[model samples]
Target: MFTLNSQSSVGHNRARTMPTSSAPRLLFLCFTLLSHFHSSVATPRHLRLSVQDIATVEAAQPARHRAKAKTTFFEVDRPLHPPRGSSGPCSTLLLSHSFALTLTKPPVTTAYSPPSCLRGAGDVSLAVLEWRADCHGVQYDRIFGVWLGGAELLRGSTAEPRPGGVTWSVHKDVTKYTSLLATGNSTLAVYLGNLIDDTYNGIYYANLTLHLYFHRKAQSAPTPAASAPADLIVPVSRSQPLDDGLWFVVQNGTDVESTRVTVPANAYRAVLEVYVSSHYSDEFWYMNTPDQNGPFREVTVQLDGDVVGAVWPFPVIYTGGINPLIWRPITSIGSFNLPTYDIELTPFLGKLLDNKEHEVGFAVTNAQNSWYVNANLHLWLDPKASTTAGGLISHDAPKLAGGINSHSLDGIDGEYRATASRNISATGWVSSSRGNITTTFAQRLNFANTNVVSKNGSEQTINQTIDAHTEVGGGGAYAHQLHHSFPLYIFLGGNGSGTSSQRLMRKVQIGFVESRSGAVAGTSTLRNEQVAEAVVVLRDDQVAGASWRMHQVYNYGASNGACYVRNVTSVGYDVLFDHDEASCGGTARR
Candidate 1:
């Protein structure tokens, strides 16, 4: 007769990549939890028997004591299978009583879909039947396999492996096995039967250890592949009207609405599902700040697991301003530190409007100066909305400003325009190479031009020019009326005594000036009354292959009088219409 005693512990989601070091982390955690669950317990009561009492009982029940009272302990160890998914099958061995328990004969097995919530249930078999013969007529071993999931081991007859099924072998010392299900459901079974078909003559044991040796599965579960790239920018109007108590207009340029999200302490990344309308892959640029009206800056950006490389399409515009600073792309992983920016200093310092008719979502970060500044985001779009209205799909027109002279109303078409009317009466003097050319002249001019289209598209244009000249002779002062139309101008005339006294050779001189300005969008008022004056040099006169110093425009406007003030110095080639001499006259005087 044989009896058995056993101890049990449960486990889950073990790593199948092979075990290393001491116990697995999850395995240790599981044991720790189990220890806590079963902390208050004593050893089995049977061990309390005293020597005298044990001897008496043994003598009274000699045969039964020799067998029924025996205790057996065994351990089957291996790496745990998939915690929640089907574990591709692997090989295992069973050891008992320090003996090589050979499968005396083939075993039968029944299988079915294992229940969920159990570890590798779909990969385990329900019950298996095996038997053997010993000196005591015939012997049988009913091996039962216990699983955490839905399963019950039972006895069965001999059966062969199914097609594509994993096989289990009984080695002299170690057994090898494999699982059939590599991807989906699994089944498990153990051989169970009487120690002997000839009842009275054989031994029967209820519980025994079936050591499990883990053999790596033939194939592992395949992982999914990575995906493509995209970006989303939500725009919200922070106009005062939409600020409605619940939302604050912290910044002007944004695609988010107020009341749509809350600010979090450390929010960095935001996911956007955008469908690219064009096939162009542009370097993404966000409004680095909240000021719609700003000298905005640009910071590099990356999303959707895509590495934004050095050069990309769409020349990156920060949309928030002109003097863009720090515009670059994120090219590495560590750069994605969460909460790397502060929302308070960010353009996201506003709330979102939750209008039901629009496509809307909240933002996870404002990324101002910090790593990840959490900010709320809301957005929406409607086909019925104004096309010129700023929205995800719409292209808004550039803002328009009024011009001078003409009533501001006349320039309302929103293009750059200006008008000036002036009355001038004056007595002038001039010195030529030899003598003074004295003259007096009075004149008034009015100039205005509408439909002004600037280099960009402004509605008004203004042109003012003035020309006056005088002649000298007979050693007497005479007055000459000089008529001129231009922005501003003066003239001198006189004849020298000796002829060909000094002949100056053709000389070329170049001059340069530099200007600087903040990149604000609106028209900047003139800071000084003087304007650039330059001497005209013919296009053909510019030395071939010689580099010329060009004026550094301050915010795209020419500064008055200081640098480009000589006749030849003010010359420029009409490069677009082929090299043609274009010139102006004046001296550098700021």
Candidate 2:
């Protein structure tokens, strides 16, 4: 029962090699909204349940428990196989209620400027799954992910010791994914994206169960479709590929409309989902070398020349591992698995539903190589309510206020220090049921990167670097609002001498938050914050080797100033991890 809304990872277009890298304005309109739809609520009632252990193929389904009698209870358990579009058949496991081994590192994350990520169906109580290994053996990095229907639930690095003998458990208390679980039969899948099937490379044992709770008193016939009976249903315009599964080519510094929609009149809400990725694995070509990885990048959505939204991709691990270099010929250096981003265009529906042809474009910024992107947009209209409308109102492009980067090369020996600063802000007015919704989006970022390298004798080199960044940003409209600031710290410094050199990489993140008002959804409130760190140190001499540590926490509460309920997850290995790290929210991002 993981519950967080989906997390996104940085995607690169399909490229054989990493290449190189590389904005605008809007209008003003002020108008008020018309009517609204408020929500209702209740307690816990399971329609059916089964409490038997799924030890054999025949025992995979849950036992039957009828809601027919009073005082009757149900025991919800894991299913033999997860529903479709889950982790796939290759990674599912049935746990026998035993957990051992210890987590080594939390998870890596990359998020964006946000105010709120709307809620779905319900909040599920999951039997957090935590798995461990005994004498496992493997070198490459495998990314583990969980999904509900088409929406991603979570992603993390795979368990170490490539070949495992015994397995343990690390459970997740997920939030923001009730729709995928509460609805009659929702799909939940978990898998390792390392391209390995369960039958090979390692011995793994898994035990996981998701139990959903719903208020029986408020249950109604399935809710109507998002845009039915009330207004208009229009396909608008689309130029997508016949087979969207195929990647669309986009060279660096260039962008693609890939698809555009001619919005129809009376539209109440417009929803867009962008499927994107990048094609650059320069890290493999020069592991840990300066500039091996691309700078911070954002996915931009534009209406004509005016920019609307920019999203930051989560940084997940894949493509690079301790494997034979020959594998390079077959796969891109970075992960090819695609992640979709959902944008609730409710705030802009007023302008698009005008029955006129409007153009929308999707592009990637700060790209070091090619970018592949496909976009899909859907609209919901209310003929009676949305009449007073117009496009974006009072907005401007983000720019770098100032910063610096300096490097020196003395033959084979070199030293460097780098820093970058940027400021981005936009303000607009949206017509909604709550009257003229004054919406403003703003963001500021500062990054500090430093590295040192030295060559010894014939073919040996020693390198060290410290890279850190901080960001503070958020947005709002009336009583519905949120603001958060976070800092990221990473350390990669070591000396490699021939066969066995000292290698270590450590990263920490603090003060990351996602907060929203119930008013935004025309309902209740929600808040989510993240704080975590990871450590990896290995010395060929064996004296400096250390374990890993990592964690992520989601917090939800009332906007009226109340304490938040936290869903906390932690993982570690032979390392002393700190869950309560200092908050770095004060650092300037603008």
lDDT: which candidate is best?
2
TM-score for each model: 0.14, 0.50
Candidate 2 lDDT, 1-590, residue by residue in tens:
10111111112211133334431110110112111100010000100011110011112212321111211110111112222222211222322221122112211222211112212242122212233322232223344444443334443333332111222233343323333333334334444322223322332334444432322324323323331221222221222222112234444434555444677554445556555554343111112223322133456767665566554443322323211111111121113233454444555655665667677776654343455454546454433564545455545556422222323333333443434444444444445443554444444444443344334211212121212121211233222333333333333233453445554333333233344433333323333233333322334544332333334443444433333343333332211222321122222211
Which candidate's TM-score is highest? Answer: 2
lDDT of 2 at 123: 18
Over the full model, what C-alpha lDDT does candidate 1 score relative to the true structure? 0.19
Off by over 4 Å in 2: 1-161, 165-212, 218-251, 255-257, 261-264, 268-294, 304-306, 313-350, 355-360, 369-388, 398-404, 409-438, 444-480, 484-486, 495-590
In model 1, the worst 10-residue window by lDDT is 319-328
